[model samples]
Target: MALLQIISAMAMAIAAPLFLGQPLFTLPVAAQAQWSRVHEIPGFGLGTWRSNGDQAAHAVEYALSLGYDHIDAAHIYRNEDETGKGIADANVDRRYIWVTSKLWNTDHQPDRVEPAIRQSLSDLGLDYLDLYLMHWPVAFVPGDGTELDRETSIVDTWRAMEDLVRANLTRFIGISNFSRRNLNVILDICDICPYAHEFELHPYLQQNDFVNFHKEVGIKVIAYSPLGNTNPIYNGRHGNLPPLLEDPFWKKLADVKGASVAQTVLAWGMRRGTVVIPKSVHENHIYQNMFSLEINFNVLEMYNISQQDKRARMNNPSESWGVELFADLDDHTSLDGNKGQEL
Candidate 1:
């Protein structure tokens, strides 16, 4: 039955590859081109950090329908097969979509980098990744939860990644969850600049300094958790700040635009020119997020929403190995300190 299903799917793809290329099996429409240009992203794309393949597939289908041309996955997500299935199900041109994946903290050592990326590629069922990132700056000796000695160095891991790019395992290489200190370390010794950087961001946690610094350095910024995540552990960090989607101001604006609060939040990211990947399992939410590309806020409305910053951050190093490294993190040059400041 599975083989039969696969054959049928392939038949569909061959029959109408361009016009009906989506996991949702929706017909192509004139609106597709507009959606593509409005929603297309160059760096980070679909993120499946906490979902299984079934859920990831649905999200990918929704993304393709909404005109997304990129998909981001990682070994830590444990859903690369599902992500791959979604790509196959979409029936889209493989060359048209940018696929990104990352090596986990446990695989950051120079020796583990190649094997880790090979395993990721195998799980993703892809020949090569469009971009590959070192999931974190710190390295962990396999099976241990602690970082290696300070002298171990990400520079060695980066060297391996540069070789992977040269060997065509991936086309681009970058980092995530890296602080300015860590980034500077890599920049000082590495030969190639990172094509992108991924970090948690939201209206309250604007991350303006890091964003500006990376832009100045020619590194694209990819915003994760743009919704001020409602995860309990994350909420605990901010003393359980109110959800941004439930705010009265956002609700009013949603009503005015006839869109969901989530959609409005995504539109803010799009308008700001940041590549955002807001995760959701619900079919409706996925479609809603994809359609957010069509929603536009007025200039005054954008400014007013930007003023809503309260310095509320959802992700922090409170429980991570580097918690101590960020203990005195009050400079506020990043999102946690600078609230209500203009970009």
Candidate 2:
């Protein structure tokens, strides 16, 4: 795909304004001064998709202390209660925080959507969510995360999501892990446009085409796993890839700027205009990741990092237990080649 070409061109164009003395290159002084100003909602946030209850709560507290006002969660994570408790502990006004949750793969059937949302709300101890998402394009049988029967199409699920928004159960509703094909299915049938789209995005697996397409359609792109399985010490499932923290290039930049590698990666995502949700249970890492908001990298540095793309995807449906059910996912070539194809 020519995704890289588009990314390269955009990077160069964005740099032009910076080189010409445009104010856009520099971080907004007002924003920097008010960094800790009452739950400010920037494009960076915490994603609780992979953590358990206690860990997620700790992460939330860490994020809150570090000036993050956005928290991404989902029914699949089974940690909404912890996330809610963490928010409550922060003593921040509910309205000040931007909370996002997702409908699971199994809850796509029209009949199952509302009940699922109600369950999530009950679990989260909230009346409404800031944003809700259809977790994936394919629908499964209710109650089973792995049962991919396709009982309900994405359009039908989207129709249900529209109803949720109309009913005020959620302020916004969007999709996750959906290809361009799946997104078109929703657009053709739904009256309301998606507010955002969440997917696995990192330097190695640079989903530039999808990001651009979402931007063109006015849908915000929320990037998950911005740090591509860097620390082998964290979990072995991540497989071995060049750790983001130790990458020679990033380390060189980090040393020059006196910033952490994690901060550098986070800044890269922010520079690209995608909301990054990096999950961590450790307090230090949480603070470290959140501090990325205060740092800004120049165009050349950002371009240098972008060139490190290896298309390494950490989360793949093909790895699930029901291998045959998701066999098509193994065809990485189709995914890599069919840029912007409808689901």
Candidate 3:
């Protein structure tokens, strides 16, 4: 780093923590911008999956003031208003922020797409979103049932999303929970090809072939739920099973690097060429996650993590949603996607 840039970065790093009540760190330009505009993104983002109301707003404020330029949210989360307040609370210009919100499945109807963006913009208190994504590949029939709307094709939804961009409701558009086949379908029919694809990706459930396909198609990969769940131990939501967070490999590596497990996991996510958004409401976790970029890994270390991929997915919605969205996950063959591919 140049003497002036190094000194400037140091000043900002020190000041960020002091003002935000959390430690903030910076990575080199090349490392910071794995994709997208260099210096415009922080690579690590805050995922407000279940965060809500004023508390969720506070998290966003802290995250923004702590030097996180990216914030990933969704319409279904029903907290865009709070997320927006947090952005406002941070006291930063919108141009410096990259706010992403997803379109809910119910709003995938051609007529509802524009309204979804409009409502999100109002809820976020923004005139334009940095990026808007289709939350799922399938459209729901809406109600207490998991009935899939057989008629609303993703192609129709993509066209409406394209309209959103043209109308200046969002700066860019993308898709989430999309398989390789889903991407191919969009590529074949899109006038505005998707800019990114968000998915469940971690060491245990690494979708190598899927990610590679995204790279080949020149679309960015955004990883959600980067940290595999350890609910059995913490929340008693399931049986007492081993959690990936407690894996010996990651723990040992983290110890060697003098970092937390979450930090190392995030660093590995970046190494794989995907920007990771791990959600946390606690102060220490937020700091550690942002600072994870400081933990440097060599080629061998990265390869070792890559080799640990068991193709074990953590977020399978097939049962709850009553749709076979990603059966590749169940069979540990995401490389091939679902048989006859579920929409």
Candidate 4:
């Protein structure tokens, strides 16, 4: 997989100039500025995936106090109520904070969509979400059993999500964990295309081509697990690969930049115009990550980081989900169609 990524990266490095030449190195200031104005999402935000109860609330409150205006939450995270309390406790003006949540797979059915968003609204104590997303491409029945819900087409679910925009349940709608093939499934036939697309992205799994596609279509890219391999949810199949933070190459770069490894990586994502949502319950880590926005990589630094791509995807459930989720990308996993719990 690493060899494949290296070859692919070399190919892209040679051919990239033919498409967008100048911005490839310099951060594309003009393009990024335009995206910022249009997207309105904070380039840096807090991710609340595993944090729950008081912990989740405290993290949200503290992050808000520390100048973070975006909070990523999901119904499946099972901490929306607590997360809302944290937001309320912070006393930050509601208009300033960007609260995002996702609809669970069970709610993919068109009829169940509105009810699900309403429930999330009730749980989060928010009248409307700044951004709402279809949690995943695959769907499941309301109850037990992991059978893929083939009856509910993604186009139907997406149309229902578009209605949420008209109904004002959420200001924007998007998708997560969707491959290019899955996105095309909606993009081919939809009244409103996704405003954003969130997925696993870091130095190791830098899907340059995939990310570029989103850019061409004007879909904002939200990078979850931006720190790479730090999320326990992903048990990598790579024999003994170190966590992204501990990589010697990244550490050396961090030392040269006088920033922590986490900041170094997060800054790389931001420099590329991708919004980074890094999850952390620790105050020090949260503070450091927010400060990543201040760090900038030079053209050489950016190129060096880009060369570190191993194409190692750490988040995948294709085997467990009974369907191929990221068939177009490398996940180091096979689709066995076995039943498994939602991540």
Could you give candidate 4's per-residue lDDT for residues 141-219 as a string of tens digits?
8866776787787788899999998887788899999878788888898787788999989998999889999999999
Steric clash pairs (candidate 3): none
Work out the TM-score per prediction: 0.79, 0.79, 0.84, 0.85
Which parts of model 4 have CA positions greater than 4 angstroms off?
1-39, 336-343
Candidate 3 has an lDDT of 0.76
- Please give the lDDT score at residue 69 for candidate 3: 73
Model 1: which residue pairs collide? 53-82
Q: Poorest 10 consecutive residues of model 3 by lDDT?
A: 29-38
Please estimate how well model 1 matches the true structure, expressed as its whole-model Cα lDDT: 0.69
* Poorly placed runs, candidate 3 (over 4 Å): 1-41, 142-145, 231-241, 328-341
lDDT order of candidates, top first: 4, 3, 2, 1
TM-score of the candidate numbered 3?
0.84
Task: Flag regions of model 1 displaced more than 4 Å.
Answer: 1-44, 144-151, 231-235, 322-343
* lDDT of all predictions: 0.69, 0.72, 0.76, 0.81
Pick the winner on lDDT between candidates 1 and 2.
2
Best-to-worst TM-score order: 4, 3, 2, 1
Better of 1 and 4 by TM-score: 4
Tens digit per residue, CA lDDT, model 3, 1-343:
3222343355555556535643276433223223223233346789998886887899999877776778998889989999999998988645456889999988888999999889998998877777899998989876545677868999999999999877767767999987676778899999988888898887777888888888898888999888876422224322243576788998999999898888888888987789899887777777668767766789899888878886666666665555566644333223233333477
